[model samples]
Target chain A: MRSKRALRYGLLGLSAALIGVGLLRQEHLEVLGKAVRICLECVGIG
Target chain B: MSGMRRNRIKWPLSRQRTIQLISAALVNGYIAGFQKGRIFTGGTKAVCVPVLNCYSCPGALGACPIGALQTAVGGVKHHFPFYVLGLLMLFGVLLGRAVCGLLCPFGLVQDLLHKIPSPKVRVPKGLDRPARGIKYVVLLVFVILLPAFAVTETRVTPPYFCQYICPAGTLGGGIPLMLADPALRQLAGWLFNWKVLVLVVIAAASVLIHRPFCRYLCPLGAFYALFNRFSFFQMSLDAHKCVGCGACERVCPMAVEVTKDINSPECIRCGACQTACPTGAIAGPLKKQSPR
Candidate 1:
């Protein structure tokens, strides 16, 4: 039981750390760039 | 009238249904975009919502995570999808398939459709078990592999799931945009027809079966399912309180074996099992219980 709790919090910390690194690298800018446009494919025009 | 009563949705609707409606509305909150037939171009577009919404939905306030993941990974630069994966992981660790049960817009659509009073078709356990595995394969092949490696002549890979499958996009983004814009209608082709067909089949299937897409093909659900066993929000069965009546199994929409595997990867944390259990042995998806 203690191990399970440790594993859960361990993953939480890992994900938060990953997010921090991604922000430092500006990876969200890539997501924003693609998202701000009208994605014709998502509209089923592809 | 009888059918409505049978579904027990005639009165003040359930808490989960209300949350689903509110969440769907807020997630697609740029209402003026629907009127003008244009996608939202705000900074919030950079953020990804946990549920499987469409970036092309004119009213979408945020990017679809799966779409963002595909685009970020499939780009010529291909620096890896750390941000998207982190966000998805965070959501999974927090809510697991409770996101599917109480938050996903497409999940809400299926729930409403299934309430249409048609004859329910119970998928055989043998077939159902295998079919459930297809969503993981979809996550591996379409959302991950194809997007990462299937580069086109144009030097980019398409979001295969969004383009080829994903009835949510076809319904929420494609059809609405197609309906509101006459000029865009001229561009409709075989692909558009194919997407519309996919939406039709899924919608039709929802009337007879519960969450066929979530069970068999949703890559987001597949991704989240991996974290279900340890997600903060979950269902718990009290073996001490349980009488092994099997009532929970009979009522489960996703066909989970509640007594043995209440936190199974397929369990959506919908709490129907909790509601169905006669012995008060089941706990919540949201309620925190001390480790027993």
Candidate 2:
């Protein structure tokens, strides 16, 4: 039971850390750059 | 008999359905944009919603997580999808498939289709068990491998799932775009027709089956299902209160054996089982639990 709790916390912590890194690196901007454009490829036009 | 009476009175708009409606409206609330047949290409599009809303949907305010993940992985730059992966992990740990049961726009569509009066068909367990694994295969192949490895000379990886599959994109983006733009109508070809066929099949099947796509084809649902056992918001069964009546099992849309595996990956956390429990054995979200 204790181990399970530890694992859960560990994963949550790791996810938070990853999110922090992603924000710090401004990966959201990269995603935004792609998203704002209507990609012809996504809609089966390309 | 009394339970049956209560359920019959509640009929078409059950508590869950009401929640589903509100969620669908809230998530896809760019109503004016839909009216104008324009997709919102705003800053919010960078952020991934937990649900399977097509990013190109006229009314969608946020990007689909599955679509964003594929796009990020399939880019020419091809860095790891840290933002998407982190968001998915965070959502999985927090809510699991509750997002599927309540928040997803596509999920609401399936639920409503299943509610239509029709002869129902349960997939035989023999075939169903193996078929459930297809979503994971989809996640592994279409979302991951094809994007990462199947690069072109220009270093661009194809968004295989969005291009070839994804009935949500077909229904939400393709139909709406074609309807709105006369020029886009000329661009429609074999691929567009194929996607329309796929959408029709899924839409037709949902009337007879409870969430055929979620059960067998949704990679997002498959991803979230992996966290069902450990998700913070989850259902628990009090053995002392349970009479082993199996009423919960009967009410489950996902067909989970509620008494045995309350935390089954297939369990959508819709609270039908909890509501159906005569003894009130099932409780949810843990924070709502009374002191033992």
By TM-score, who's the top model here? 1
Query: Which runs of model 1 end up more than 4 angstroms from their true locations?
Result: B1-8, B286-292
What is the TM-score of each predicted model, taking all chains together?
0.95, 0.92
lDDT of 1 by residue, B1-292 (tens): 0123234464586677888999999999999989998889999988899999998898899999999988878887766788999999999999999999999999999998888876688899999999999999999999889988888888788889898998988888998899899988889899899999999999999888889999999999999999999988868777888888899998888999888998999998777777777777888854433343
lDDT of 2 by residue, B6-115 (tens): 11225577666777889878767788766777778778988888888777777777888888888778787787888889989998988889888877878888977776
Interface RMSD of each: 0.8, 1.5
**Model 2 bad stretches (over 4 Å):** B1-12, B286-292
| Tens-digit lDDT track of model 1 for A1-46 | 7887888899999889888888888988888988888777887898
TM-score of predicted model 1? 0.95
Instruction: State in Å the error of residue B31, model 1.
Output: 1.0
Q: Model 2 - which docking category?
A: medium
